[model samples]
Target: MTLRGTVRTSYEVLTSRFGPPTFPQVDDGGLPAEDSTLWLIDTPAGRVHVHNWLDVTYFLKRPAAETRWSIQATDDAALPWIYKSVTGSTAAFSAGVHEFSRYSTRVSLARGYVTYLVQRMIALRERGERYDQGSREHRHQIELSRHVGHMALQVQQIVHDVEWAYADDADRRRWTTLPMPQLADEPESQHWHRWTRWTYRPVPTDSRPEGGDPDLVGMLRRRARDQVRFRDRILPANHRGPTREGKVELYDEHIGTLLTLADTALPDTVEQSRS
Candidate 1:
């Protein structure tokens, strides 16, 4: 139950259930420095737990009975936006929280994986610059870059799918659009006059904002509607369909802005909550 080893530890854990999760060659920056992790996490019933290097204490925390585990790098930082969106998600979940745990957890894990891989690739790229031809280190550099490229593609795909799902027309109408929000920098007295609209919007309902520009609201809603219709055609009944990862990779390679939308789509509960 409590198994610990090198990188192989995590590999064994994933293989036990999924029968060997295939990793596309990923290159983001550097080779892992022996301290990375692989984890088989078990959360307590009715409670959600996340594994990271932070020091927040919660009551009644228990060590997971590890079936299989691997260690991977966590020292590398993620893009600020990733942290922002992920925090928003967990906060949203904890507040009105529904337990659409599976999809929600998958999205979080995928984002973490992508962020880690990108950091690793950047590290590798830095190391490769000092290589001597025909040296083992040089060869390793080439291999790492290959992996980074693959990982980058994979990250792109995840973003595309989520954005497609959120931006869809149906989703847009559901989440109600917010065309403008108040600025903290605006003086309390001047706040009413300082409203500027954001083209970015969500569908379903516009309950979040105090008020928004009428024109921007309409435009955002229409755009959200159009995108939802476009994406609905693409989502497979099983989100983890055989080609799910592959389809995401294809989108990452060809389309840009993959990162922007990946973090913003619905939390796991949206679909079920809506119904």
Candidate 2:
């Protein structure tokens, strides 16, 4: 059979759906099994062979649940069928947002999940350090840490699918579900100059969105009115550096900060960055 495609997924991900491998290596077999495990998936396209070919060498390095085995299939049309069978998604590869929730929904859920995963990882590290080396407690923590990391990657994979998740341009354009953003607890005067300080007003959260679609038109109006004080009442000043070289030098020195600010300020839309 000709190798048509490969599915880069973990053993658990495959076995949970396709059941255990039809041909797993002998339990007490000697090391270096060329085909460690083989799953014969009967897809609608045809029967395909999904196996960890020559993975015995590297499989032990990572947890079996997280290790990405290059599962191969021979049928020319088996890849799509395999994907459809596993995910139970009948839609075509180019399916649109009707097949899923809005992009903001997944993104917000991902944000919360990633945050929790990070906290779990940190706690695992701290707790693991307290145990003695080679002890069962330490080993258990190590296993838990690895699983937490694997979970983070899984969340990343799900949330990165933005094209099929987003509704449209109107649905894509959104805020963080709340008009009144959380502040840094301290007064803005400490960090901002007199100019930007006035723009940082404490708005009432009663009008903010609870969870679902927000009144973006109203939010924009309020945002502009509250933040664009310099254009209306305040007399703004424009000062240019003496030489182009000086401005360029300052920018070069702070390029990292500028790039970070740009990244946070201008996020890419699903349409703009669908790969």
Candidate 3:
């Protein structure tokens, strides 16, 4: 299929399932000659972003069917809805990569969902003390804990996928040699060198820094571990304690640490690659 054909087919499938998009598609200017298109569709599940782009390298050699396309959720809550709608299964809060295909279009759709679940886990942890034992909120938290545990494993799968995709002998050695990050350890270092070290230290056994962008790899690893901690330790422990007012503080600290590590390691611009 040509790039335009793939996009048209994708749009048709989406419209059939979710109705027409809220707005017209827009052309996002791209490198000299290639065309790029962006579509935004609002569904009960949340806003979905559909982007299609022509490869720029040896630009003329690739076929239109080869054009890359991505479908992503704009927010966390929309994920469950999308998952159910796409899979036709009861929305299990369980995590892992979810792929849906129609008319040759495939989407990897679990990362955002897991991220949103983590957010929920954090909120429940902060407010656990407000609910009486065996009450609705307490029961909900318990159920969510199980979901979060499954989600953590899903995140681990993603991390493992990345690690395998990019692993090399040197990368393996780096991980085996470095110390893993502890749950209490705050990723405070702003220098790329330090940030990279800290992010890899915690999962030295599974981490591979040589495969793709180091920063992106590190972020994924750190976030994966953070989710695991929230599911296994932080939330459970907090639920057992008296209601606390410091949830927001703790949440901010966690977000700040991730942001700092990201800022330190990510480059200002990413160059598009041709497949």
Candidate 4:
């Protein structure tokens, strides 16, 4: 299939709307050899084909697909629009680069997201006064802040599950007690550094650095909760914006980062009922 634009989203997101995909030999308890985990859907423009592409190496590691799947269509001829129509996922229509199998834990994924959100929030603060209420820029401001609140909620309720998976509080603390990653002037670069170190101390390894300062779990959690309160203070003045006309722009800003993070802790992916 000719690689077109990609939608990095959850398997459940796909299956919820399209039913189970072409799960070839799923009952055999064997890893799929070909691109067997596939989906086909009809849209006004054309049929959309969704698959795992070349990310098969990790399939055995997970009998289930990743919390997200990078869908590369067979054609780009108005297919991006069709994809948005069918899957309701954020899509970018360009023959994008192929994605590889990436490994990430729930805690690391959430931590990386926290890094991106805080840094992005700082950037937004620098320009918040510039955005007029009910304007396009205002929408960005509202959405970003609201999502921060949403993320903080995710951290306390969902990311905590990952922490609890360990045998004891020390081990749990070890998972979240990471080191700061070096920040960048650019968002993507900063996100990569934050997530890649994902573990900066020898929680198991020390890979990325953020000025070498230790990242305390309790402090980070408190910081995120503070953002939730901050959003509430500002939300009364902000709405999703007059309409949904250009709301997906944040996807451009944050979606790619999300797929990169692949925070399985996110509840969006596990919504499927296997039974």
Candidate 3 steric clashes: 5
TM per candidate: 0.29, 0.28, 0.33, 0.29
Q: Which stretches of model 1 miss by more than 4 angstroms?
A: 1-104, 169-275
The TM-score of candidate 1 is 0.29
**RMSD of each predicted structure:** 16.9, 18.7, 15.0, 14.9
Backbone Cα, N, C clashes tallied per candidate: 41, 0, 5, 5
Looking at model 2, residue 140 earns an lDDT score of: 61
Q: Write one digit per residue (lDDT tens) for candidate 4, span 1-275.
A: 44333555565456566776665444366656465466766643345666765434454455445444444433333343434444543222221222321222224435434444454444554455578876767666666665544543443343443334332557646556766655657565355435544543322325422122133244344544554454455545445653332333443323433342332222211211121
For model 1, residues 1-275, the per-residue Cα lDDT tens digits are: 21111111123333344342232222465433222222232221111112223111211132222322222222111222222222322112211111223233324433443444454455565677689867767666656555555644444344334443445567555435544555677433233222211232323336523232222223323433444443455655468733444344423321322323233333432354355
Candidate lDDT (C-alpha), each:
0.35, 0.41, 0.41, 0.44
- Range of the 10 consecutive residues with the lowest summed lDDT in candidate 1: 1-10
Judged by lDDT, which candidate is best? Answer: 4
Better structure of 1 and 4 per lDDT: 4
Query: Clash pairs of candidate 4?
Result: 180-210, 181-209, 181-210, 182-209, 182-210
For 1-275, candidate 3 gives per-residue lDDT tens digits of 11111122343444456564433333466333435444565644456665556322322343223333455553334544443443332133223111222211111123433444454455564565478886767765655555544553444354444443446678767765766554554322113223334454233333533343334445544774675466455555545432222333333333443333233322222121111
